[model samples]
Target: MSSPEQTTAIVDAATDPARSPRSLREAWLALAGLSAVFLFEMLDNSILNVALPTIGRELHASTTALQWVTGAYAVVFGGLMLAFGAVADRFGRRRTMLIGLALLGVASLATAFVSTAEQLIAVRAATGVAAAMTTPGSMALAFRLFGADGLRVRAITLISTVGLVGLAIGPTAGGLVLAVAPWQVLLLVNVPVAVLAMIGIRFGIAADAADELHRDPVDVAGAVLGTAAIVLALVAPTLFVDAGTGSWVPWAVTAAAVPAAVLFVLRERSARHPLLDLRLVARPLVSSGLAFKAATGLATAGLGYLVTLQLQLDWGWSPALAAVGMLPQVVVLIAGGSLVSPFVERVGLERAAAISAAAVVGGLAVYSLLGRFGYVWVALALVLVAAGMRVVGVAAGTNVLRGLPKERTTIGAALVDTASEVTSGIGIAVTGTVLAALFTGDLAASHWTARQTAEFQQAATVAGLTLTVVAALLVGWGIIRGRSAPITADDSDSSAGRDDSPGAEADAPRAAQHAG
Candidate 1:
């Protein structure tokens, strides 16, 4: 059997598409498409964090309501990725992406005009649905544009890096906007970026409709169940009280969610073509990569906001000052991403990813300990942590896409993004709940005295440590379990060619169909 690289070469040799342009032109087009979409999505993700206080004051949004603004986006975005990915496959990448971008622009424009908190929340959910379509479609389209093996890995790395850079610099970027412009400007900003990407996608990238789009009935049942499961999970913290409250409401909601999820899984397995492909996720490579994405993205995304709050609330740093302090880490993230790409092909995906994960675990552990000193130590810790994420993020994303059949690329990318979004959403909610619990418990016990303040501080330290340990464990598990199977489309196709016998013609079509 040929190796992944060799098989990729063979596949490339067999049905060489006419070279319409140089590889550089193709790569640049993909880069432009990816970076534009990523900037829009990630900018929306982080912009709210920087502007939340202002938004709250102007819009009369309570803490709970503000949480919904972020959570609503995450829940809807994560819930519908599978549906959107399948739609993209059924239709065409260019067509689906353009539609999604237009909807996102409309949603963003609507957000600017929202008067009530409910209206803003509703628009954000709409934006989330649009985001669900954009992120995964963009990635899968990149894979299709650049072929899946060597070219795909490099392109995925660059795209992931660019997105991370946007996230890393988002605080400063959001601050700059807020300082000069109104809070509504953040939502409106997405309008121009989405338009540019839509135009580029229309002209620059070629479209490929999935040759074998799922003809199975749309899995409406599965989508409903899955959406319920995610929503219940996301809102459980809010619906029920903290650990001290001893509320059974949380437990019951959680227990019900598990069974609903089980039903969703069973339905998916039995259906001809489920909205979300549970079968694809059964592969070790895909699952492990997604696991890495979820755990790492959760900790990293939530912690950025945590650090920003610490800088502003605890250390009395201005928003702009905090953003500046974070600039070095953002630079390190970009550098880290570029440095790891050469090693990914050289050392193999699993080993390279494991080393990167080890770095992440170490870096985050340092943050769990050193984060309390002040902005300086916190900045250093973040740089190291972001550096580690840069390497692992690329590996996790590329390896998952690399191992799948060509047909599953879009759905798989959607699943990966969904995993990250869901985890990040859950983590933020959990962390917020913990902080709130500590604050209330301390204050109530002492009537808001000095001792209560000390207790709150102590609780924060403990919570930070516990979260760090959990993050480290998840990252380590992903590394230890991250093994890519030898079942790519190129490998399967090559194997089929080697088996030319009496029934070869009869089986060739079946083999090709399955490979797809």
Candidate 2:
């Protein structure tokens, strides 16, 4: 989705000696700079889970307050992501990211000085807002920097590896920080990283003029409605539930969703500038990619949550010890991220998705048999998990942006990201419920007395088997859809400016209708 300005900057950066290197080294450095931001920003997502108890003790936070400290971040980040994506498209991606970086640095520094739980919660919320602006913009920037499909795929693979590393590194890294410093120090560490990354960004990307002047006005109404819908959709489900509360919460939320969704759709349809172009949503690449990414989040998060239960609750391993056992998973993830591009480019998107599905099924099969062989099976399973995730992530991203207009690329990326984020929350809820039920059932097997590891082991086996079945069905569907969906001419092109179609000509007005 490189704008003419971005295209010129990249071309100039290559030809001009005053900026980045002329060789492939420039691309590597650029990817590293953006990936650094992604790694540090996303690392915070799970890092706080380990330090919550420490934060609670020190700040005397109530259970609800502690949840707010973390939940505030999730809520704000999820709510504002698409809005920021539209903002990035309207403004400049690099500018959007620079502002985000500044905010993250300021918020991280402020977080270190917070005295009360409320202050911490506020600081986390600010950081979440910064992350929302940064996430899709970063990916959009990556696309603009490397417009070639091959190069874009490589960049995506690298970024996905950094993300998984960030996720996996959280508890391990947080545990290390807790060993030597206060929880506030965890927030403090990002300041220097942010500063360093800003420097990388300055040198790595060319300065481009603002886009808003040329683009349609920002979709303020759409932003408000879309943000409200996302926030309400995510928050209401959890916030309205309690032992004494009736089933009215779900129904009420559903009722509320109708108006919000209807309003948002109506706004997009009629507005001079729509936040989400309804036309793009009709495209196979856009629609299917978002769906698959959601499935990826669901399957990946579900597996991780269940494995965590098995490792710590059932097997009596410490958090640090459990992370150590995930080394195989991490290694495979790194390798798979580095390698998925050629395979994806060689085969089509759907076939690659199918391959990823097979890998997940194989991995879970190993995990389901873990009781018989020991932890060796765990290691074996993780290798397949890592391989599967990399292919799925890369292919989904590639397909989403394929044949998409450069100017509106951020919009599509935003939708894919929003799906992943929302479904990640869904995965947490679903897996938590399932695992909780499994734990209670294990206790019941022991006649409500002392539960044995054997009972938990049995539970783990069932969970593994269940996930395998789900994955098989899910991927099978993807394979079917992939088989049926038609690939556009732009998808096969080496470059993105393939405007040889009548449909693309019609898209010009849609592009001008609104930013994102």
Top TM-score hit: 2
**lDDT string, candidate 1, 357-450, tens digits:** 6565565556657677655667776876677677776677766765566656777788777777667656665666566666644332313456
| Local accuracy by lDDT, each model | 0.68, 0.69
388, model 2: CA deviation in Å? 1.3
**All candidates: CA RMSD in angstroms?**
7.9, 7.1
What digit string (tens of lDDT, one per residue) describes model 2 on residues 192-227?
A: 867866775666676543431128788899999998
Against the correct fold, how does model 2 do in TM-score? 0.80
State which candidate has the highest lDDT.
Answer: 2
The residue pairs in collision within model 2 are 1-406, 273-513, 273-514
Measured against the true structure, the TM-scores of the candidates, in listed sequence, are: 0.79, 0.80
Judged by lDDT against the true structure, how good is candidate 1? 0.68
